[model samples]
Target: MPIITRFYGIIIKMYFNDHLPPHFHAIYGEYNGVFDINTLEMTEGDLPNRAVKLIREWAELHQNELMKIWEKKVFKKLDGLK
Candidate 1:
């Protein structure tokens, strides 16, 4: 997995040549969740409430960039939420 961003100890990543629906993985400690870039819905696993909110906000802010990267099928590090 390649980390695209990190915020509040939440690590956001995506696997190269990953599956469909344009999603990313958010891992915090032992918890992990796969979130859709377009819908911002958790597809698998779970995270803490604070982590959830932060991830959602960050995803919303970077949705476009996320989509672009997904479309290109590339793994690049992204700036963390500020």
Candidate 2:
């Protein structure tokens, strides 16, 4: 897994050549979730409400970049939520 960003104790990552539907992983404390890049929906696992909110906001801000990285199968760090 490659870390895409980190902020407010939230760590965002994605796996190279990962499965379909284009998604990313978020880890905060002991909670973790796999979020769909397009819909911002948690496909697996669970996260706190605050963490989910932050992840959604951050994803909205960088959706395009995320897709680009996903399509290219290249990982790059992204700016986290402020």
Candidate 3:
């Protein structure tokens, strides 16, 4: 997966050029995961103790923006807001 965004305890990524409801991949060092941008569900993978906490917080903080980026990306928006 491509590393799109990275922060203190999280890394946001999109993969395989596919989009339905919009989601992102998050990684926190020893912990990595695939999460839904809409419901904030941990669709797959595991996160470490601190990573889990940070992932939850980061996702909540950027949920809207993440979803928006996913939408714009898949839809091929010319002036996409990233």
Flag regions of model 2 displaced more than 4 Å. none
28-66 per-residue lDDT for model 2 (tens digits): 999999999989999997799999999999999999999
Q: At residue 73, what lDDT does model 3 achieve?
A: 59
Name the regions of candidate 3 deviating beyond 4 angstroms: 74-82
How much lDDT does each candidate structure score?
0.88, 0.93, 0.67
TM-score leader:
2
Give, for candidate 1, the lowest lDDT window spanning 10 residues: 72-81
- For every model shown, what is its TM-score relative to the native structure? 0.91, 0.96, 0.70
> Could you say which candidate leads in lDDT?
2
Candidate numbers sorted by TM-score from highest down = 2, 1, 3
RMSD value for candidate 1: 1.0
lDDT of 3 by residue, 1-82 (tens): 6566667746677874675656777777777787888888877887866666667677787777666677665422121112
Q: Where is model 1 more than 4 Å wrong at Cα?
A: none
- Kindly provide the TM-score of model 1 when superposed on the true structure, using C-alpha atoms: 0.91
